[model samples]
Every structure is written in structure tokens, then in C-alpha cells.
Target: MKKFLLVFPFLSLFFYAGAQNKNLTMQDAMLNARTTLAPENLSQIQFVYGTEQYVYAKRSGNDVTWLTGDFKNKEEKNLLTLVELNQKLKAAGRTELKAMPVVQFNQGADWILNIQGEKVAYNPAKGSFTTLIDAATAAKGNVEQSKAGYTAYLDHFNLFVANVADAKQVTQDGSSDIVYASSVHRDEFGIAKGTFWSNSGKVLAFYRMDQSMVADYPIIDWTSIPAKNVNIKYPMAGQKSHHVTVGVYNAVTGTVVYLKTGEPAEQYLTNIAWSPDDKYIYIAVLNRGQNHMKLDQYDAVSGNFVKTLFEEKDEKYVEPLVPMLFLKNDPSKFIWQSNRDGWNHLYLYDVKGKLLKQLTKGAWEVLEVKGFDQKGDNLFYVSTEESPITRNLYVLNVKAAKSRRLTSGFAVHTTQVSTSGQTVIDNYSTPEDPRTILLSEVASGHSKTLLQAKNPLADYNTKASEIFTIKSAGGDPLYCSLYKPVGYDAGKKYPVVVYWYGGSHAQLILNSWNAGAGDYWFRYMAEQGYVVFVMDTHGSDNRGKAFEQSMFRRVGDVQMQDMMTGVDYLKALPYVDADRMGLFGWSFGGFNTVDFMLNHPGVFKAAVAGGPVINWNLYEVMYTERYMDTPQENPEGFAATDLTQKIGNLKGKLLLIHGMQDPVVLQQNTVSLVKSAVDKGVQVDYMIYPGHEHNVLGKDRAHLYQKVTDYFMQNLK
Candidate 1:
């Protein structure tokens, strides 16, 4: 990928000429960008990744068919082609038919499909479908099938149990306001997985989230009649949160028991897991502020709190419950990732939350825990031990406490380890290479090429990326990447633009594939007599939790300090004009950019802050509270970090861009900043995309980038 970028000077020139249309509309700009930034089909999906079997609904020879893979092998035979299966049911006197594929049966004999909201067992051999459970009106959670043919679901906000013979609702008190079976907040943005199927699949445990008492944050959509308002029960920073509880349902007896959490409604219950024997449930509970966490166990049947297995406390804030690792061979044993030891490391723990051993200990943080091997002894994870700016795969032995580096090379590797941890699909690139995908062995490190994206911009004449390192005023090393324009000269000084995100849990300077717009925008700026630089500061991602958590309580201070140091570093460069430096960023990056311009106005001549969080007090609780704590507790910190409060000190030509309907960093943030600047008699440029959200999607992004580029050129140049 790096070589392609380096060699494609001509292609870059052609793209630049074609893309540089002054009168182009926002739609046209987006269309042009998409044409250049076409994504590749990697044959990866949510459930079935890298599988030859293509699951699709198609019409075949007068019959609608549902097929998985090539229908050559008997085991790979048709689960059910829609037309034939429906005709057979119609011939059996069942006219109304609706079948949707559910969970894949372990033995691959048949798939559990939903028909009219009821689970049914469809046999390919008999061409028949039998009703396993009766139809219900509410949404059904994933079905759990036991070896004894018992099935269960979270129907009508409560657990429902059934066997091959009959079905019954296990829980009685379930309503729209009181949900018992489904995950709250649509399971996105750090919601824990709800279903807990035992090892034998005979018992099931599920989460019940009650949001009746929580206040709703109204989301107004003008597209609907009378302007529809979606009342999202959002837990904003320092706000009342939803209460979550766990319940165990017996598949054979049709009984349910609610686990006792003892924690108040404001607390969170997450990472719930059931024991192998279905005797106990383990859960991680955190307070509203998210500074303290407790790993608790409960009796599955008796609904009694057993004991506190482990506790983690932080002076700043403890991280919320991420997904936990459970051993397949010994369900009593599990693995945990924590920053209590000052670095994110893996720890082996028993069901009682007793520390069995420390698996991996180092300064590097484990990016992900990608399942255990077949034996459940070795754990596969991605880490940045090689370089803070790069990620690579690693494997650790649970019992031996030994670890091995899986990928050792210059290119940065992001990997997806298979469920068995034997095979990995590694995607990597560097400054000198294009993105190349490889399938490699976890233990042996042998790999085969899968896909190497051709550099479509190879024919464009462009300058190459120059990598450099700078030491901050505090003597901490910061990695920076500089992009020079095509056909450069050393005689004349050029305007320098610093693109930065300088936030906790983020890294911008990386040896990886670059998007066409990003590359073109940077290259174009350089081509137009501007120097482009991106620096990854100390409080960035991939480094362990300590480095990221350094910004706690002082969100914008340390990052700005590092960025100002980078400005000094750039000012020292012979080719960069000290007076012509600009900064731009989106979201958290935008917050940094604006805050820097306001607080340290002398360092930046121009800045563009897009979709910024002007005030921490307005953000959501889960993410904001983790880093800044509750505003009630840290009032001074919140007041000091508020960009709107510091707008009076703005010195730069600032362009404030925002999406009108941005849900993450709401549009009100931009409005507040603009109002503050106006009240202080400060001049600022502003633009808003009407129907856009936090990110300008499709063609809007092109218009956005162009707008940003034009603004920087006009102001900084």
C-alpha cells in the first residue's frame, strides 16, 4: 500500500485535476469522492466471516430458495429454499407463511427459523416444518436450543420457555416500560450482550433493563408528520440512568428467578455470565460516576447475592464493563483485562473472581481479547507493543503465563483471529505499501495473501509522506507524519496545517492505509504550497490505559500542551512558516482544535472545529462520566475545560462547522460556541449541513473537506 502511494504520482495529478471543480455542488463533490474511495468486498460478515458459504435469498427454477454455500455436499444441502418450503407448508394446509433464519444449530442438521413470531424446527429431509413454540406479538430474543430439545426466548419483555411438546411464558410482570429480555439502547455504544446460554444449553439467563423512571431525551425528526419526537431514554453525564437486572429461566420447568443486585437504580449491571452448571451468575456492577467497580456473583436459582469476587477502583475513573472471557474447558476459570496494575494486562480468574494467575503483563495494552483456542488455554489478542502507533497480533498461554508475538514486521497489522485462534485474517499497510490482506497461522506465523488493494491513485503525480519524531517541552517523544506537495522546493517557506485529534484513546500518526479524500486533501494542500502534519501525542490510543487516562479530570489541558509543543516543533522546521500554521479536527478532535485556538491563540493562526463538544456537561453519561466524572463532582474541571467559556480569548481565524442534527456532539454545542464568540465581539466563520449528523456522510463529506480546505487556504495562506 505504501509503495502504491509512493509510485502513483501521475494518478494523483489526474485525480486532482478532475476533482478540483470550483463550482461543483456538494452532491457532485461527494459522488466524485466516493468514486475515488471505493470500498472492497472482503467477504466478512457479522456471524460468518471468511466462509465459502454464501447465505442469500434468491429465485431458482420457479422456487424462491434460501441457500448456504454450494449445494454439493449433503451436509451443505439446502436448509430451505423459500418457494419449495412455502409450497410444502401450503400443501400441508398452512397458507400464511413467514420464515426467517435464526441461530445456526451446532450439529448443522437444521436451522431455527421464525414463522409468524414463533420458533419452528424445519427438516430438509421431510420438507416439513413443525411449530416448536406458539406465536407471540413482541420481539423475540435469540433462541437457545438444548440437547434435550428445550427452547427459550425473551418474549414480551420476559423469559419464555418451551420444549418440543409445549410452550409457556416464564415471567408474569413484563410490559413496554419494564423490559425483561432485550438489551437497552439497541445494544450499540457499549451495551453488553444479553443472552446467556449454559454450556449444555439447558438453562438460560438474560438481562432485564427498566427505564420507566429515567427521563427521555427527545430526538426530533422533522421528516415525520407533526415532527416526530423519539423519546430516547438517554443517560447523559451526571443524569439518572436505567436500572438493569438479570434473570435465570429454567428450560424444563418453565420457571424464572431474578438475580439480586443490591445496587441502586443509578448503578450499572454488565458483563453477566452464567456458570457451566447454571448454579451461579457473575456480573460486574459500577456506580453512576464509573470510578468504582465490583465483580459480584449470585445464586442462579435462589436469587441471592453470593459475594464480591473482585473490586477495581480508580482515583480518576474506572472503565465500564467490557465483554469478559470465559474458558470453554473449565467454566469455573475465566480471563479478565484490567488497568489496575497501571497497564492494561490479562489476568486469569476463577468463578469466585480469585486471581489464578496473570497471563500477560507489560506496558502495552491489549486492544482486544479475540476468543480462546479449542483447548481454552491460549488467548489471542491485538496489542501495540511493537509501536504505539501500530497494532499487531499476539497469543498468550493461560497456564504457562508465556506470550508470543504473532506478527513481526514493519507494516502495522490489524487482525481478526478466528474463533479457534488458529487462523487470522491480517490487514496491514505502511507508508511505503498499499493495504494487503493475509491469512496467517497464529502459532507458526505462516501466511497466505488474500487481497491486495490496487492503488487507484498510482498514476497521479504526488509527493511522498515524510515521517518524523518530535520531543515535547516535557521531553516526551511524539510521532509525526508530514506530507509534502508534488514537485517541492526547499527555498521558500510554506503554510503548515496541523491535523490533530490529541484526545485520549486515539492515534492519528499510523503506518496504515489512507482514504483517497484524506490523502488527496493533504496532498492537494501540499501541492498548493502548504505543509501538512499529523502528530500522535502522549494521550492517544493503543498505548496502555495510563497514557489514555492521563487526560482524566483535565480533558483538554495535557492534549493542548502536547499540541502546542508540536507547534513549536513545526515552527523550528525550516520549510514551515511559523506565522502561517492552522489546525483542524472533527468531534473530540474538533473540541481540541477549538479549545487550543481559544486558550493558546498565539500558536495557531487558523482553525476549523467540526461537530465539537463545547461543553462536557451536555454529553452522554457512559462515555463522558468515565473520563470527566460527574459534573457535580468536578465543577471546576468542567468550567475550565468548557470551550465556550474560553471563546473570549480566540485569536485565530476560526471556522466552526457542524451538522444540524448531530446526536453525539449536539448542534447546540456549535450554537453555544458561536453565540459566545459573537457576545465577545470575536469574528468566526460558520457552516451547518441541514440533515447531517455527527459525521457528514456520502457526498456531504466531500463538500465538507472542500469547505475546510478552502477555508484553511483563504485564512492561513
Candidate 2:
């Protein structure tokens, strides 16, 4: 691939010869960046179920008015108003809504909404509402409602099913250690929720995690009087992990049966899916080693092991994130995404696990599988076929095995296909463009720009932003982004602040708004006369498996090498001050910042790391074991990346920050390093947010940024 330096043309909208001059305040940059400083968006923009018309909400005064438009209509019309919607709510004996709740049109032309925690159906024509699922019954979270009007939720740790009239407890043995109807495996393998509702809503499958064998880890709450210890079950690498099982609940008979997975009991059962007919359930069962995975089927009613459809084995690791997407028109066929062939691609399989066809194949990976058309003939998806940093929409003709790009340009696009799949809404953004939404016809590829959002920072003077690629040490292209200081001068050198998260399952640089900085902090620093830089190293996401697996058994080695390649590029620039460079990152990036400063001493003059992982052994079992294996099996690899062991070599000004309540990367990781710094007679600064979690969110986040800025200014600047 040829490399090119592409300066975003859309920057001209915000940067000009003499338009305005305004610098970002700390509060605006950190707290309100996603709100006041964020780009304008169409609220609740979606296709009305089974209709060509799409609706969006626009604020009128204190309330919003719902508006609808279609390709044929071309003119927007009012769909509903707060006053009328409230009248209906009052007539139905419900509390009148002060504001318009997020409403979705159902197949019957009625709207479905979750109002006051209850799933209700509103008939716009009749101006009435019928509660589909009662809110009082759903006292706990993890709520899931089936089409059959049955609701499932977790009360305490036990699973419960309820209808409009009554409720029933499905599990009686649930306790603090024995969890049910909740996410398992620390929410790995893309398991966001535990409840799985079948097509007809006849059966509900949920996860049962037994953590009695795991060790207890304490998270101190300093806010309490004299402080308090909250113990949580945290399974570490090379330690005994929690055992998990699947339970099937029959809504008709009110009986539960557990699947006979049969194993060492510590294996991971991920990607749970129900058959279209609700007769069988499929699970991607991965072993403790994570190198082998079996796609197994079980009878949903009896909980008997049906058969092992197929198995996938990888020398490094076999990770199955997405569940099987069964075809609606043909229940016997399904689409499975895997990286078995070195890239994440879609494979068509029959009920017997026989390969029907490979739906997609290439160097680029499919980022998401949207859904099929009303006829289930064509499939919609998002991928990086255009460029690794850009996500574009594509439509695949399943029968012909052909794909066509429905979206264009080198930008990130998130799409929503219509009910009939004849039209789609593409919401995209570039470094220059904050947001641009287009309504396009999938058949003709003709599109009309629905809205072109004005730059939120257009009135404020901003510097130039560039998105390009650089060659890594191994000659692979590393995507990079740079935000130059305001009023940049070619002859004058300026201090540089490098922000990065060089870890798996994340990408820092993209051809999107603000170069995917995600906040105004980078621009805020640039306005302070510091060049801000970010690079997506080889191990980052959206790249193929080989690119990511290059760091297998050695997490920080390849990432640091690629990051140094970016640093070298910065140092070579005439306007970058090589003598005064600093680093900042959070979580995995925090680990990288500390690792880089220690491993490559004197490279960075100052650094700040938040929630850094000092040792792999202290991290969770599922994520750490996948990348670094168990500590017993790869002690040498673990020893190489351990920052506490290399604290004595630290030469730069280092500040470690942690959220005391962070359960993800426990505060212990940073405290252990603080202890090691004392042992090594090295000076290390530290700060802790008493009530914050892995991330210091809301207004407190501004304080975190202030501390970071002050550290860089006092030490490096």
C-alpha cells in the first residue's frame, strides 16, 4: 500500500486567516465536550417500523415535537407533540410525561416505549396506552421482555419471570456467590447481557455464574466514615476461576433445566443463541486455555446435549465474540463470524454445521453485521474494505455471494437500514466534518444529505488536524493523528504531548471528527502551545488477527515498538521539541505509558498514567489469559512486561493516578508499584479519586485533566 499525507480539508471551516480567537476552558474541554461542544445530531432518527417513513425529535421549547419524513414525501411533517402524547398518557391512567420519551413505531403502526420502567404500547390513533410489561414487577435490572408479553429480570441474584397478572421465581438457589440472569466471565467475549429471548418468546435462556471458588478482593471506600471494605469476587490469571452454566426456562410450564455442558466446570460458555423455532440453543464453549472452542447445540426443553456442530482451534487463541445470526426466512441456515482464517469474516453454515459458503473474505474484517432485508436475501454490514481507519457500509447478496458498498468516502459511517432494506440512513464524520447524515437508496446508490452539522468549534480559533499513516519498525503502516498548536509557526519548536492507548480492542486514530480524540482535551492542550499526537499501533483494533496476535504472550512489546516509530516521526519534525516530550494514557494506555517510560528510560521527560496495569497477574483472568496466557505458563513473558520489576530504571517524572473504587484495573496494581518505588528509592507521585471507578467521569473528570495538565506544565513545559 502506498502511504500519503492527507491534511483534512474540512479544517478550513474552523481554521481561517482571521475569524475568531477563543481557547477551551477546562470544564468545556473535559465535562461538556460531549454535550455543548459536541456536534448537533438528529434525535431518535430511525425508520418507523415496517414503514418507509422515518421520524426524528426536534426541541420546540421545553418539550420536543416528533417529525416524520420519507423519500417520496421529501417534506417533514409533525408526527406527535408532547401535549398530545401527554393527553393519551393521562387517559390511560398513567402519569403524564413532561418530555417526549424515546418512542419507536411497532409493526401495528403503534409506538412501543419504556415509560417509567414499564414497556407500554401506545396507539397514536386511539390516543391510549396499554402496559405490555409492568414496571413494579421489574424491580431489579437485567430486564428482558419477550414478544409473548413475558418479562424476565434478576431480583437480588435469583431469576424471575412475570406477566401482567403475576410473577414467578425461576431459581431458588441464587445467592451472593451463585449469580443468575446476569453477565458472566467478567463481560468478556462480547457478552453484554445474560438473558436470551427466543424468536417466539416461548423460552428464555440465561447465565448462571458460581463464584464460590474465586478469591475475594477488597475495594476500599474512603468516602465512608473511617472507610469501609467492599469485597468482590475477582478471578485472577493462573488462579481458580468461577464456574458458569446455562439455564433454560420454559415460560409455558414454569420449569427450569440446566444444560449438561460437562467439563472441568471452569470453561467459558459464550455467544449464547436460541434457534429460530426455540427448540435448541447454541453456545460457543471455550476451554480454560482459550485455544479451542466448540460450537455445541443443546435441546432447549430437556437441556440435553444435542451435538457438537463444529470446533475451531487456534494455536494462540480462538475468541468467539458474536453469536450466530440465524436467517429469518431460512431457520436452518446461519451466519458465523470468526478469525480462523487470520481475519474476521462471515461464514454461512447449515443446521448440521456444514459449510454452505463463505459470505465475506478479505484482508479487511467485518466490523458489524447489521441485519438482513425484509426478504432475508441481502445482508447489511459495516467493514474496513475502503481503509483500515474508515468504517463504511456494505450490502451482501447472500445468494450470489457478492457485496456492494452502499457508502463512500474515507470516513467512519454508522448506518441504520430500513425495514424493507430498500433505503438506509448513513451517519458519518471526518476529521474536518463533525457529522453528516445521508438518506440513501440502497438499490440506486442515490443519496440526499439529510443534515450537514455545522462545526461546533467554528467560532473558536482552532489549529490544523491531520490524519495519516507512517511506517512502523516492521514496515507496516501505523495510522497516526496530530493536532498542531494554535497559531503554529514553522520555524519555532514546541513541546509535544503524546496521548495513546496502545492496547487490544481499541483504536485511537481514525478519519473521524476530532481525529477520534473523543474529547476536547487534546485541543485544549494544543491551544496551550503543545503539539498533541495520537497513533494506533499495530496491536490496536480493526486490524487483522495477525496484526493483533503479534503481541501474543508479549502484550507491550509490539505496541511500544510501533509507538516509538511514531515518536521518531515526531522528533524528526522541525517544529517538535524533542528535548521536552511527555506521555499520557488511561488503563491499557496507562500501562503502556509507564512501560514506555521505564523500558525506554529518558525518552519522555514527564508522564501521567491513570489506572495502569503494573502486572498481568493482577488483571482479570479472561482478558489477561487471552493475551499473555497464564502466569504459570508464561512467567518469562509476564516478567518482561511487569513495571514494578523495572521501577528502579525510571528516570522520568512519573505520576500514577487511580480511582480507589475501580474494580476493573484494581487500585492494587498502582499501589504495588508505589510500594516498589519506595523499595527502589525512587520518587513517584500519586493521586486517587475516592468514589470514581475505572474512569473519572462527569465533572470530576475535569479535575483529573487539570492535574494532568499541571503535571506536564510544571515538569516538561
Candidate 3:
């Protein structure tokens, strides 16, 4: 691998950077982002990316039906009857159904079944029933089914493969030091799944994490009648980290082969992609230093290294979270996504490690791939090509490398493509439109509305949010948004609360419906006559690698610089009260929230930081090292970013909140921060959620948010 440098346009030297349509701002972002109820659907739902065609269950008043054609020539098909599912569930001792049960089909929708509860299957034609597995409320490990009718799951520390008839233990070791069939690297590097089935379903590839050498941190469970101590393998920065390997299991042979993605054994193996032929596996192997990465190909059969397709290195870091996609017809040629040129785009490469061509290039990043056509002639993708704030679909000819904008309207569109690439299922919303799920025809660019979700908060009086652009310390433009009081009086200054999470890989603001997501508390606070300001600034996501890495070797510095620039702008506004400004954040935003209260003392009279990382030294290796390097490598940087050093500078009613059982940020961070504050004679307020983790969620979330609002009102007001 060779090292290289690409100067980011718009002056990498300087950078800076919200809004809500009737949507949620960071203050209330996604405060109601979750849905507790499931929508009724047909046997299955499928969408064609970049097109207005899709297959889904359509409901018309009292009539519910399924369609299997384009938007224009849609054909209704009777897949199953209510009588059939009720009969099947009744035989299985389930209560008689109300309407029709939500049934899921196989990948190809060849069969319909109830994946939940008893896992019952129905043969609509024959009116027969098949119970795949017994009713299970939940299991110790996650249970996932393969297209080939095999179920793979984790049984505590071991991995298990099973079917309706029989089961087999894939891993035998039960020691807590080792884990099989589990998400590793604290779920970073986009590694969310452990078990991956081959294309033809002959093998199972799973992650084996050995944390025997890592440190065991004790988490207290205080809710029990008698407190319980839970020990977890927590690898801190520069510490002896856990090792991971990929093991492939052949179901027919009952043989296992581990990939030889050799390393210091502590390196990160991410973005596992299987070749179309199922003969090879590709891994984006990142070194422990995190500055260098190689897209390595390995033989699935022998676990032998086939070749290093390419490598990427950067002075700050090279994060490879996406895997390569092999062409459907041409296995020898594959498409790889990279940000080497300062923007994420697509590049075509051959199996021989030759760069065939650059498919897409520009200042925009491809947000997601909606999949290719059945023939692989066209590729559909959602991108920031339209505007960084919005997501729209585009279709590209794989061979010609030419792309056409599929979506024209100004809105955020999360698209899905059909097998033939002729249909697109567009789930989009605007500030004016709460949600509009459409079926778009790829060739004609015509769309038919599938569902227009009415405003969920129509009855509630929510003040519309406004977006603004502010310049950062680096002279780059930053987007921000705020919600004013329901009945605003410009003659009077309103207390303003600035909430943000300016960390890597997460962009808080967007141009979607409901301004992407909002906080209900923000609306409540607005109704009570306060302004809520939130910004997605530099050192965060979407812009480019350089924009995010501006804080390299320093965690909370640049983020705050940009944030304060925005705050200063807000302070100048006639309606925003400068003296009553407050700040709030969670996780990375939490880390910086404390950083701001202490580093920039008096900026916020009151503040709340939940689940914060007190010091980089205490954070996990992969993430911390990527941004801050090892504590030993950058002692001064660590010293500058650590909250312990700035505790004495704290000059506000600072409230530090934490989940006692937080594995990511850990309760130790708040404990350490509080102790340092005491040692330095600094006043600090604190709270702990007995059984919560990194985030205070569920019912407790409302309580936590209310507490934050109360703290700011008591102190800032």
C-alpha cells in the first residue's frame, strides 16, 4: 500500500457547518422516531430502486389487497385469505385473528408464513399448515432464518445452526472469554451481523471474538433485590484488545475453515463480502493503527489469501465500512466505493486488482445502494448528488459509467429497486408532506402514491422549525435549525437551548420529512416560550472524510469551535437570549457537551451531558484510535480533550447523566468526571439510570428528557 494525500476543496484549513420542516429538530429529534405498532402488509413487500414500481399490500378503506405489477398497470393478486391464516393459527392454539395476520414471504416470496410466534407456514392453494418451529417469545441469542430454510443463531457463547427437524452446535466453546456468532468491535466498522450465508446456502460465515486477554469491567445491576455484578470484556484505548476471526462452516461436510486475514490479531476485519460464485470472500482489513486498510480477497475453501485487491491510507485515518459488490453477470468485475478523492464515489475494479474505471465522481457521496437490476445492466443508488441535505435516487449504467437522475423533486427519498430495476419504491416526505410512499416507474419516471401517511401530530400545535446557514471557524458553511416559541414576540428575548452531536459517521440534520426526526420535548419547550437550536457541524458526517477528520488527535476541539460559531450567531439574533444559553448532547455530543461547559466555561449557564466518554484513554480501541490515536501516541492531545483536566474550569450548573450499565461510554466516565470535579473544587450535578445502557431509552427516555429540561430551566432561566 502507498500513502497519498488529497486536498479537500473549500479549504480543508477551514470548515464549519439544520432545520426542520414540520419535522423534529435535534432538541426533539426522533423523540417520537419509533413506531410501536406494525403496519399490515401483503405476503411481502418489494420495491424497485430509481423507479416508481413495487409490490406491496395496498389497503383501500375496508378493502385490503396485494399487487404484483407496475404502478400504471398494477395487477391485484389474491395470495391468501383471512380464513386460511385464521385456520392455521387456530390449529396452533392461537386466538382467532382480527383481520389478516401480517405474513412474511421467503426471499422470492415462494411461500408465506408467520415468522413470529409459532413460526407457522400456510399452503394457500392446498389450505394446509406447517409449523416451522415452536412458538418462542424471545431467545437468548438472535434467531435469523436463511433463504435455504436453515436457521442460525447464538446460544449464549456458542453458535448454533438448526432447522425444523434437527439442530447442530457449530461452536463448542462456552467460555465467556470467547464469543461466537455475535457482533464484534462494539458494532463498529458497520459490522452488525455475525452469521452470513453463502449465496447458494452451502456455508455459514460467522464472527469469532476472543476477548480472553482484554480487561473485564464490572457493571453493577442495582435494580435487583440484591445487586448483581456483571463482568464484561471492555477493551480500552491502547489496551490489550480482543482478537477476531471469520470462520466459514460447510453444512454438508460439517467442516469449518477460518479465514487467514492474519494480523497483529487485534486489527479490525470489516465489510465482509462474498463473491457471487461463493468461492471467495473479501474483507476490508484495517490495521490496528487505523491509518491503513487493504481490501483482501481470500479463498473460502482453504481460507488462503488470494490477493490484496487494493489498499487505502490517510494521515488521519482510512475507514472502510462498505464492502465491494460483484457484478451479477461479470463476477470478475466488481464495484468498490471509496472517498480517496475526498468524496465517496464508485470505482470499478477487476479480480486481477486492476482499476477498470471510475463509475461516479463528484462532491457528493452515495448514501446507499438500492441494488442492481436482475441483469446487472443498471445500478440504482441514493446519493447526496442533489444536495447534501437531501437524498435522491439515480440510475447508472454499470459498463458505460453514465448516470441519470431518477428523482427530480426536492425531498429526501430512501429508495428500493425491484429485481428488474424497472420499479422504485420511494419512501419520502417533505416539510409539507408528512410521508409519501410511492411506486415510481424507472423508464417513464412516473409515480403512483402507495401511502400518504397523514401528519401524526396534526392535532398538536407544534411550531414549525426554521433552517439557517452559519459560517464555521474554518470559513466553511454549516447548516443549522431552530424552533421558536409557539407565539413569538421579537420584542422579548427567549431562552435558547443549543443541542448537538457533532461526531463522525452521524449527521443530525437532514432535508427529509419532519426535518429527518425531532424531539417532542423541543416542541413542549417551544410551547413554553423557548428557542431550541441544533446544528450538524464539521467533524460529523456527509460532507467528506476531511470534514470529519478535522478533529484528528483531538476529540472535542473543532466540533465546539464550529458549534460556538453558530451559538454566537444565535446570540446576535434579537429574539435569542444570550445570557440564558444552554447546551445538551448525548454520547459524542455528550463528551463535547462537558467539554464545552468546562473548556468554554460560562458559554452555557446550564448543560446536560449523558453517557459521555470522559477521556479518550477510556474509550474502545477501534474508534478512539482512529480519531485520537493511542493515548501514548498523543499524550498532549489526550490531555487536552480529557474532561478531567478542565473540571476546575467548570462554571455552570452542569448535570452529567449516565446509564449505570452503559457498556459503550461506561458509568466509570461520569464517575471519573465527577471525582475530578470534586478534586478540583468544581461543582457538578449527576444522575444515573440503574439498569439503562449507553442511552436512556423507552419510558425512562421521557423522564430523562424532562429532567434535562428542568435542569436548564432552573439554572439558565
Best by TM-score: 2
Give the residue spans of candidate 1 off by over 4 A: 1-42, 45-189, 192-195, 200-204, 224-230, 416-421, 442-444, 515-524, 527-529
Candidate 1 lDDT, 1-717, residue by residue in tens: 011112222223222323332432334335543454433324331112333233434444455444444212334345355556668778767655554334333224555566666666666557677765656522456565566566666665666766756678877787766776666543532564566777667777777778777676665776777877666565667877678788887776667788888857677777776766778777778777677888888898788999998898887777644656778777778887787887777888987668998888777777777777767878778877776666788887877999888886655787766555667767777554456766676667777665677654454444446655667656656777777644567877888888888776567766554421233567566666788888777667766666678788878888888887777767776878888888988888998888888888778889898989899887777778778888998898889878888887988799989886677777778888889888999888999887788898875677888899889878887
lDDT of 3 by residue, 587-656 (tens): 9999989888887888777889989988888889889999989999999998998888878888878899
- Tens digit of lDDT per residue, candidate 2, span 1-717? 223354445345234424556778998788777898899999879988887777898986687998988887678999889887777777778898776888887345679887887778987668778888776765577888888889998887788998777889999989889999999999999999989988888689999999999999998878789899889999999999999999999988988899999988989999999888888999999998999999999999889999999999999999999999998689999999998888899999999999899989999999999999999999999999888878999999998889999998878898998889999989999877789999889989888888999888876767546777788777778887788888889999999999888788898877788877778888898889999888888778988998989989999999888878877889888999998999999999999999999999998999999999999999999999999999999999999988899999998899999998999999999999999999989999999998999999888999999999999999877
- lDDT rank order: 2, 3, 1
Superposition TM-score, candidate 2 onto the true structure: 0.97
70 in model 1: Cα distance from truth in Å? 16
TM-score of 3: 0.90
* Candidate number achieving the greatest lDDT relative to the actual structure: 2
Error of 3 at 192 (Å): 0.4
Tell me each candidate's TM-score.
Answer: 0.79, 0.97, 0.90
Ranking by TM-score: 2, 3, 1
C-alpha lDDT values of all predictions: 0.70, 0.88, 0.77
